[model samples]
Every structure is written in C-alpha cells, then in structure tokens.
Target chain A: SAVISQKPSRDICQRGTSLTIQCQVDSQVTMMFWYRQQPGQSLTLIATANQGSEATYESGFVIDKFPISRPNLTFSTLTVSNMSPEDSSIYLCSVEGQGAEQYFGPGTRLTVT
Target chain B: GESVGLHLPTLSVQEGDNSIINCAYSNSASDYFIWYKQESGKGPQFIIDIRSNMDKRQGQRVTVLLNKTVKHLSLQIAATQPGDSAVYFCAEIVLTGGGNKLTFGTGTQLKVEL
Candidate 1:
C-alpha cells in the first residue's frame, strides 16, 4: 500500500478565487490522478497527472479550469481556477498501487462561497 | 458515453451478517473493476479489485464477484462491522491511450445496524 497526503485538508474560499491542492506520495508512482467528489455523488476523474508532461484531462474538463502539475514521481498539484459554488467539492489525489488498485489521500474539501 | 451504475442507492444490513452491494456497467471493454469505501469527509479507500480474467477475488473479509455475461459486479462483506458502514462505489477501468481511467458508479450507502 502507498501512503498519500494532501495539503490544506480543507479550505473555504470566496468565489472567483483559486486554490491549489498539493498531493504527495511516500514513494514514486507511475500513475497519479486527481478526482472530484460532489455532494453525495461518486468520484469523478478530473485529470491524469503525468510526470514531465502536460496532464491528460477527461472530457467536460479543461486545463484552464483545473491545472495539474506533476514535477516528479512523488508529488503533484491541482489548482481550481476561478472557483465557483459548483466547484465546491472534495478534491482527491490517488496513485495506482500494486495490481491496479488505487490508493487515495485524505481528500481536500473545498467550500466556495 | 459509458457509465457504471449501482442497482440500489442504499443498503441496510445487520452486524455480523453478510452484505452484498451490486453494480452494473455499460462498457464491455472494461477489463478491470475495483471496489472502494468512502467514509464521510474522506476519500474513497480501495477495498478489493478483480480482473476480467477472474470471476471472483477475496480480501480479508471482503469478496468481489463479477459476471461478465450480465456486465454486473458485486461486493460481499462477511460479518459486516460498524466500520464497514460507508458509501461503496464500484469503478471500471477503461484503458485509454493516456492510461487506465477509472469510471466510478453511482455509490451505494451501506448502513450496518447492531
């Protein structure tokens, strides 16, 4: 199992502001991903953070809105740009562990007001 | 265009009894499936995973069963404990050019009553 951690476990920000959440893993991983969990909803994949390359985002998501940076194998950052009330959700960082099982960090809960 | 969905939104089970949560997927190309448990205010935690080549896989007290013919999946927890109460989600891994992406299903809330 891999140990993962996220910065600013939670934060409340004003609308139109941006917040960057950081995710760190204890060891190097080949695949790291950012996910969002809306209120009472299942997890949605936002983007796949690639080391030294631009992140691969899913449909309906764009880099302008959610920018991701994977500087190394053990660290990544996801920024929620121009936040809105709808963007108020838990942001999670996960690393694909052994046998395709993904291990997640304690998500960063963001509340936009 | 593809989706993973659960048959039930909520399940209530008595402690020490067996519990089963069901899921259905629309993508037949998906070859890997995983079960996750998310407690309130926390991220989804991996419980167990099963590959398409196998019909069943087991962890400590958890078992995952897959029926490819029906595109259905199930997670069975034996002797359900209070800690097992949480929202459970089943996700299918779709292999893409970028990497393996997980499409999660509508979660099922499991309530363990003593």
Candidate 2:
C-alpha cells in the first residue's frame, strides 16, 4: 500500500483568493492525479500531473483555474486560483499503484467564503 | 463521452449480512474496473479491482463481479460491518494519451445497520 499525504488538510478562503494544496507520497510513483468532489457529489478527475511537464487537464477543467505542478515522482501541488463559493469542494490527490489501481491521500477540504 | 454509473444512490444493510452494490459502464475499451470506498472527509480508498479478461475477483471479504455482456459490475461484501459504512464508487479505467483516466460513477452510500 502507498502512504500518501497532503498538506493543509483544510482551509477557508475568501473569494478571489487562492489556495495551494500539496501532495507527497512515501515512494516514487509513475502517475499522479488531482480530483475534486463537490459537496454531496462523487469525485471528478481534474487533471493528470506529469513529472517535469505541464499537467493534463480534463475537458471541464482548465490550468488557469486549477494549476498543477509535479516536479518529481513523489511530490505535486494543486493551486485553486481566484476562488469563489462554487470552488468550495474537497480536493484530493492520488498516485497510481500496480495494475492501474490508485491510492489516494486524505483530501484537502476547501471552503470559499 | 464514456461514463460509469451506479443503479442506486444509497443502500442500507444489516451488520453481518451481505451487501451488494451495482454499477454500469458504457465504455467497452476500459482496461480495468475497480471499486473504491470513501469515508466522510477522507479520500477514496481502493477496495478491489478486476481486469477486463476476468469475470470475478475477490479480496479479503470483498468480491467483485464483472459482466461485460451487460456492461455491468457489482461488488459483494460478505458479513458487512459498520466499518464498511461509507460511499462506494465503481470506476473504469481507459488508457488515454495522458495516462489511465478513471471515470467514476455517482457512488452508492452504504449504511450498515447494527
């Protein structure tokens, strides 16, 4: 099993502000991803964090709103910029394990007020 | 767009009884199907996974059954416990240009009654 950790387990941000959540894994991993879960909703993939390259965003997500940086195999950061009340959600980070299975870190709960 | 979906939004089961959660996926090209458990305020935890070639796979007390004919999947947990109470999601992975994109279902909230 992979031991994944995230910084700033939660935060309350004012509108137009930004928050950056960090993710760290115990060992090197091949793939890292970011996800969002709106209140009372299921998780949605935001982007795929690539090592030494810009992250790949999903169709509904954009880099400007949610910028991602994965400098190495074990660490990454997701910044939610210019936040609004609609941006209030739990942000999660996950690493791909063997056979396409993913292990997730404890999510960062963000509330934009 | 490919999508994975669940039949029921929530399921209630008695402790020690078996619990079954069902899912339906649209993409036939998916490489893997997986089950995940998410507790409140926590990220999803991998429960079990089955490959496309296999019809069923078991882990610990959990059994995952995949029916490609109907594009359906089901997870069976024997002797369900209170600890099993959480939101369950079934996801399908399709290898894309970026990586393995896991499309998740709406999820089923499992409530174990003691």
Candidate 3:
C-alpha cells in the first residue's frame, strides 16, 4: 500500500481560471495516473504521467486542457487549464505498485463558479 | 476503444446481510480486473482482483467472481456493516495495447442500513 496525498483537497474557483493540483507519493513508483470523477459519475483516466517524459492523455482529453508534469518518481502535478463550469469534478492521482494494484491519493475536489 | 460497465446503479442491503455488485466488460482481451471502493469525499480504495484465468478470488469478507464466457464480474461482501456503504467500481486492465492502463466502469452505490 502507498500513502498518497494531494494538495488543495477542496477548492472553489472562478470560470476561466486555472488550478494546479499536486500529488505526492511516499515512495518511488513506476507509473502515475490522473483521473477525473464527475458528480454521480465514474472515474475517467485523464492521463499517465511518466517521470522525465511527456504525459499520455486519453481520448477526449488533451494536454492543453489538462496539462501534466512529472518532475520525479514521487511527485507529479495536473493543471486544469482554462477551467469551466463543466470542468468541476474530483481529480485523483494514483500509482501502481508491486502487485499491479493501484493506490489513489485523497483527491482534489474542484468547484468552478 | 474499450469500456467496462456495471449492471446496477444502486444496491441496498441490511446490516449483517450480504451484498453483491455486478459488472460487465466489452473487451475479452483484458486479462486483469480489479474492484474498488470509494466513499464520499475520498479516493478509491482497492478491494480485490481476479485474473482472467481464475473464476473466483476471495479477500477479507469479500469475494470476486468472474464469468469470462459472458464477460461478467461480480463482487460479494459478507456480513455487511454500516461503514461498508460506498460506491463500488470495477476496472479492467488490457495488458496488450497500453502498459497497465485501467478502464473503469460505471459505479454501483451500496447502501448498508442498520
């Protein structure tokens, strides 16, 4: 199990503003992922943040909207750029460990007004 | 190109009773599957997983059953407690195209009443 933490656990932002969320893991992990969970919806994979490499965004999501940076093995950041009311959701960071099971951070809840 | 889905949107059960949540996947090539529990205002927690080669796997008070023929998966919880109330999700990992990429399904909210 990994102890994962996210900054700005909950926040309210104005539309057109951007918010960058930070994710930290207790130890080095091979793969880090970002996910979005809309209210009353399932989790959607936003991208995979690989250390020292460009993150891979999933379909319907792009770097321009959800840019990601993986500075090191234990830390990463996801920036919700040009935010809109539809972008309001819970963002989570996760890491896959030894047994191939993924552990998730506490998640950042963002509300755009 | 791939999607995982659940059969029910909500499930209600009494305390001390058993609860089962079902999921279905579209990709037969997926070899790995995982179940997750997400409480309100918290990240999802891994519950248990089963491989395509196995039909069933058990964890502490929980069991996962896989039916590859029908591309169906189910999670069973025994002696449900009030604290066990949460949204449950099932995910499938296609080891071929991407490296350990997980596709999550629509969640099932389980309500355990005392």
Candidate 4:
C-alpha cells in the first residue's frame, strides 16, 4: 500500500470556472490513475497520468475536460476545466500496488454551483 | 456493454454476527477482482482480492469467494463490528493501454447495529 494525499479536500466552484486538484504519493510508482465518483454512482475511471507525457483518457472522458499532469513519479495534478453542476463529484487518485491492487487517496469533494 | 453488479443495495447486521456481501460481474475475461470499503467522506480502502484461478481467499476476519462459472463474488465478514459499517464495492481489473483499470460494481451499504 502507498500513502496518498490530495489537496483542497473539499471545494466549491462556480460554473465555467476551473479547479485543479493535487495528488501526492509517498513513493515512486509506475502507474497512477484518476477516477470520478458521482452522487449515488459507482466510480468511473477518468484518465491515466503518464509521467512527462500526455495522459491516457478513458472513453467518454477527454483531455480538454479533465487535463492531467504528472511532472514526476510522486506527484500529479488533475484540472477540471469549465466546471458545471453535472461535474460535481468526488475525484480520487490511486496508484497501482502489488499485483493488480490499487491504493486510493482520500478524494477531493468538488461541488460546482 | 458488460458491467459489474451487486445483489443487494443495503444490508443490516448485528454486532458479533456474520455478514455477507455479494457481487456479480458480467465480463468473463476479467481475471482479477478486489473488494473495497468506503467510509463516509473517505476513499475506498482495499480489503482483499482474489484471482480468477482461485475460488476462495481469506484475510483478517474477511473472506472473498469467487465462482468463475457463475461469475459471482462474495465477501464474508466474521463478527461484524460498528467500524465495519460502510459501503462495500467489488471491482474487476481489465488490462488497458495505460495500465490495469478497475471497473467497480454498484456499492452495497452495510450497517452494523450493536
């Protein structure tokens, strides 16, 4: 397991604004991912943060909406651009642990008004 | 359009009693499965995991059972406690270009009453 932390644990943003969430890990990991948990819904993968390269996004998610930046191995940022009420969700960052298991951060609770 | 699902949305268990949470997956190609517990305002915590080749695996007071033929997975908790009250989710791992991605099931809320 890895120790993961996210900045601005909770935030409220106005629609059309953007907010950047930061995730810091204790150790260097090879794989890091971002996920979204909507109200009363299951988690959906947003993108994979690649070190020093463009992130790999999942279907229905685009880089323009949720841009990811992984400058180094232990830190990454996810920016939600042009937020809306529908974008209000809990954003989580996780890293691959031993085998196929993943350790998740506490998550950033975002509410777009 | 396969998905992971849970048998029940909510479960109530008395303290010291055994609790069982069930999940079902539609994708047979999924080889790895994991169980996570999410507390109020907290992220999902890893509880236990099992591979497709195995039928059952055990952890501290927790057990995971997998039936490949039926595409069913179960988590059994012995002597449920108040701290065990949370939303439980089961996820399946699929290989992706980025890495292994997890597709989660509808969560089951577990309430433990003293």
Candidate 5:
C-alpha cells in the first residue's frame, strides 16, 4: 500500500468560488485517481490523473468542472471550479498499488455554502 | 447491492458476533471485485478482493464470497468489534479508457453494538 496525503483536510467555500485539493504520495505511481463521495452516498470516480498529461475523466464529469493536474508521478491536484451546494462532497485521492489494489488518502471534506 | 433511497442500508451487529454484508453487481463481464470499509471523515480502506475465477477469499478476520451466477458477493467478518463500525462497500472493476475504474455499490452501514 502507498502512503497518500491530501491538503486542506476540510474546507468551506462560498458558491461560485473555487478550491484546489492536493494529493501527494510517498512514492511514484502510474495510476492516480480522484473520487467524490456525496452525503450519505457511495463513492463515484471523477477522473484519473495521468502524470504529465491531461487527466481522463469519467462520464458526467468534465475537465472544466473538475480540472486535474499531475505534474509528477507522486503528486496531483484537483480543482473544483465554480463550486455550488451540489458540489459539496468529500474528495478523495487514491493510487494503484502493485497488485492493482488501491490505497486512499484521508480525503478532503468540502462544504459549498 | 443497489438502493434508490437517499439513506443507506444499515446492519446492526453485537460485539463479538459475526456480521455479513451482501452486494449485487451489474456488469457480468467484470472480472475483479473489492471490498472497502469507510469510517466517518475517512477514505475507503481496502479490506479484501477477489477475482471472477475465484469463489472465496479470506483476510485476517474477513472473508469474501463471490457467486458469479447471481452476480452477487458477500463480506463476512468474524468476532465483530467496535472498531469495525463503519460503512462497507463492494466495488466491481470495469475496463475504461482511463484503465480500470471501480463501480461501487450503494454500501451498507455496519453499526457494532457494545
């Protein structure tokens, strides 16, 4: 498993504002992903952060809303743009381990007011 | 499995008793499955995983059983403890342009009663 950490563990942002969440891993990894967990809901994958390239987003997600930047293999950032109350959710980052299993970060709890 | 309501399915178990959580997946071609536990204010933690070719897999005190015919899987925890109180989720891996993505179930909230 990999040691992953996220910055600004919890934040409250006003609607129409943007917040950037950073994820750092202890070691280099090829596959890093961002997920969203809504209140009282299970997780939903947002995008995959590809090192040195544009992130691959899932259906119903766009780069404009949730832009991702992976400058290196060990770090990535996800920015939620033009936040709304519906965007209030826990954002988590995870990395793929050796056996295809994933290790997750502590998660960033964001509340859009 | 899947639920349409806003609330999650919950299971209450006594401490030291056995607990079972069940899930039903959608994709029949999905070859990989994983179980995760999420505590309040924390990310999901990997518990155990199994493949389509296997029926059962075991971890420290947890066991995973898969039934391909019914597209169902289950997690069994022995001697449940207070620390085990959390939400459990089952996920299926599907091939995607971004690689394999996990599709999660509705999740079951496990409440361990002392």
Candidate 6:
C-alpha cells in the first residue's frame, strides 16, 4: 500500500472563495484521482489528474469549478474554484497501485460558509 | 456511465458479531472491485478487493464475495470490534476511453456497539 497525505486537513472558507488541496504520495504512481464526499451522500469522482496534462473531469464537474494539477507521478493538487456552500465536502486523492488496488489520503475537509 | 451501489445505508451490530455489507454494480464489464473503510474525519482506507474472475477472497479477518451473475458484492467482517465502526464503500474499476477509473458507491455505515 502507498502512503498518501493531504495538506490542510481541515479549513473554513467564505463563500465565493477558492481553496487548493494538495496530495502527495510516498512512491511514484501511475493514475491519480480526486474525489468529493458530500455530507450524507456518496463520494463522487471529481477528476483524473494526469501528469503534465490537463485533468479529466467527470460529469457534473467542470474545470471551471474544480481545477486540477499534477506536476509529477507522486504529487497533485485540486483547486475548488468559486466555492459555494454546496461545495463544502471532503476532498480525497487516490492512487491505484500495481495490483489495481487504490490507496487514499486522509482527505481535506472543506467547509464553505 | 456505470455506477456501484449498496443495499443498506446503515448497519448496527454488537461487538464480536459478524457483519456483512452488500453492494451492487451496474456494469458487467467492470473486472475489479474494492472495499474501503472510512472513519469520521478521515479518508477511506483500503480493506480488501476481489477480481471479477474470483468468487471469494479472504484477508486476515475479512472476506469479500463477488457475484457477477447478479452484479453483487459483499464484504464480511468476522468478530467485529469498535474499531470496525465506520462507513464502508464499494468501488468498481471501469475501463473507459481515458483508462481504468474507479466509480464509488454511496457507502454503508457500520456501527458496532460495545
């Protein structure tokens, strides 16, 4: 299993503001993904952070709202732009290993007021 | 556009008892499945996984059963403890045009009482 960590474990921000969450993996990985878990709801895939390329956003999510950057195989960041109360959720970063098992970071809890 | 889902939203069980959480997926092409545990204020932790080619896989104290005919997956934990209390999720790996991506289910909250 890969050791994954996220910066800014928890934060509170005002509406209309943006917060960028960082994900770092101890070892190099191939595919990195970002996910959103809303309160009382299931986790939704935000985007796939590809190294040196534009992130691929899932349906109902766009780059204008959630921009992602993956500088290398072991690091990535997700920026929640133009935040709203509905944007308040836990953001997680995951990496699939050699066996296709995924490892996740602690996640960043964002609360938009 | 395939999705994974769980049968129960919440489960309450006594400590030392066994617990079973069930999940169903929409796509038969998905060849990989995984179970994750997430505590409050924490990210989801990898528990165990089973491939579509297998019917059952066992870990230290956990077992994952997959049924492709019904598109159902179940995770069974033996001798549940308080530490086992958390929200469990089932995810499917669907190989799309981009690559193999995971789609997570709603999740089942398991509460173990002392």
Provide C-alpha RMSD values for all models, in order: 4.0, 4.1, 4.0, 4.0, 3.1, 4.1
- Best-fitting candidate, scored by DockQ: 5
Instruction: Give per-residue CA lDDT, model 5, range A1-113, as digits (tens).
Output: 88999999989999999999999999998889999988889889999888878899989999999999999989999999999999988899999866556789999989999
- The worst-scoring run of ten residues by lDDT in candidate 2 chain B lies at B1-10
lDDT of 6 by residue, B3-84 (tens): 1223438899999999999998988999899999988777888899888899999998999999999999999999999999
Question: What's the alpha carbon RMSD for model 5?
Answer: 3.1
What TM-score number comes out for model 3? 0.95
User: Given candidate 2, what's the lDDT at residue A112?
Assistant: 96
Please list the residue runs of candidate 4 whose C-alpha ends up more than 4 Å from where it truly belongs after superposition. Answer: B1-8
- Candidate 6 Cα RMSD (Å): 4.1
Q: Enumerate the candidates' DockQ scores in order.
A: 0.45, 0.48, 0.46, 0.49, 0.50, 0.46
Q: What is the interface RMSD of candidate 5, in Å?
A: 4.0
TM-score for each predicted model, relative to the true structure: 0.94, 0.94, 0.95, 0.95, 0.95, 0.93
Identify the superior model by lDDT, candidate 1 or candidate 5: 5
Provide the TM-score of chain A alone for each candidate, in the order shown: 0.98, 0.98, 0.98, 0.98, 0.98, 0.96
Candidate 4, residue B98: how far the Cα is off, in Å? 4.0
Candidate 5 backbone clash number: 0
> What's model 4's overall lDDT?
0.91
Scored by Cα lDDT, where does model 1 land? Answer: 0.89
Q: Model 4: DockQ against the native?
A: 0.49
Off by over 4 Å in 3: B1-8, B96-98
DockQ for model 2? 0.48
Model 6 regions more than 4 Å off? B1-8, B96-98
Choose the strongest candidate by lDDT. Answer: 4
Q: B7-77 in candidate 1: lDDT tens per residue?
A: 33889999999999999987999979999998776778888899988999999999999999999999999
